[model samples]
Target: MSESGKTNPMDEQTPDAVTEADILIGRIVDGEADEQDRTDFERLADADPLLWRAVATRHQDMASLCDEVDHEIAMATTLELPDFVAPRRAPRWAVALSGWAAVLILAVIWTTMPQSKGIEGLPPARPVQINPDDELTFEQHMQQYLLAPYVMGELDPIVFRVEELPDGRQAIHYVRRIEAFEFLDADEELPVNDKGHLTIDPSELHAPVGPASIAETVH
Candidate 1:
């Protein structure tokens, strides 16, 4: 009552608890508060716009320090101080004076954001492209000479192309060359510099190689 019998706006608040300016100053500036202290500060801020503004000014005095706090304050490892979801950049001096609070904010941001540690170690891979139109598969050329009958019914058998295979015999299309077919073992997937050169199946073939049918290799 202003030490007299007159209605005062502040008379409704706790006399010894804290002043509105003091509550805002404590909550926003110094960040010291108990449960009742925070409640009192909230009520004061709701009732007084000047108190809220004063608090904002004091907070921004430490620019980049005022940030988005977490939804539940308990999630903040350093209770009372706000949780920084996204780090704000400012002059080093602004955060420099705040001690570990600044470090904590930066740590949270680094953990949450996508940042590369060893970016220089990796170079982008080159794309491999093949022009499918010009390419010919081994099966396509098998018909040209492998089955051309020199003497019909004089011992003929269907031939399989093995040019794509390295351990493979010579081409049947050349001369009277008769290519022999062989079976490869399970462990016989030999690594080759040119993968197209090795087309032997990892599993055994239907028939094992005996001798070249004609006689000596033509080439």
Candidate 2:
């Protein structure tokens, strides 16, 4: 198989040398051979009995390894495992008591600490003593009305009258109004004048006494 009259040493390779038949046999054993590779392997296997025996031996070895692995997995799963105990949780009442204890401790710490008198260069705050006989100023009355829990939205204060008292103090009379909306059925109609304005009766309405009154006297 050489250009010279003598035979080439490379052409007569040893049995250990890898050939195309060996590669095709390896592909077939590994299950990676396509239709063309399978056809080629079949042709090679028919030509050589040794190659066919090698592939059959490889398949038997693979099946035996798979069976051994499956047996190991089954034995591992069947072995007795240690019992797992979950951590116990505290009672609801105990948790609540601990929270209250923390709050009490914080309260004690806060109360025991020295209270600040006043900021530096600023005068100490004086305690205000309110007299029941004295009428509230306009600003004080407005502040009280605004801070009331029932008050909502903007306050529409209409000054009805302003007069000077005998004590040289001015008295202001005002009506505090609040606008609100209510959902009604389609058939329900509000009483409106010819001017297309809703009319409400003042006498039919009622409110809380003292600072919460709609109409109040402020000095």
Best by TM-score: 2
lDDT of 1 at 203: 24
Candidate 2: tens digits of C-alpha lDDT, residues 54-143 = 777767887899889978787565444321211134222112111101110011122222431111122212233445345443223233
Name the weakest run of 10 consecutive residues (lDDT summed) in model 1.
97-106
Candidate 2 TM-score to native:
0.26
What would the per-residue lDDT of candidate 1 be over residues 18-118, giving only the tens digit for each residue? 44455446565666766777677677667665666666766776454444343344355433433132134432212321111111111112232234221
| Predictions in order: lDDT | 0.36, 0.43
- Quote the positional error of residue 129 for candidate 1 in Å: 77
User: Top lDDT: which candidate number?
Assistant: 2
CA lDDT for candidate 2: 0.43
RMSD of 1: 33.3
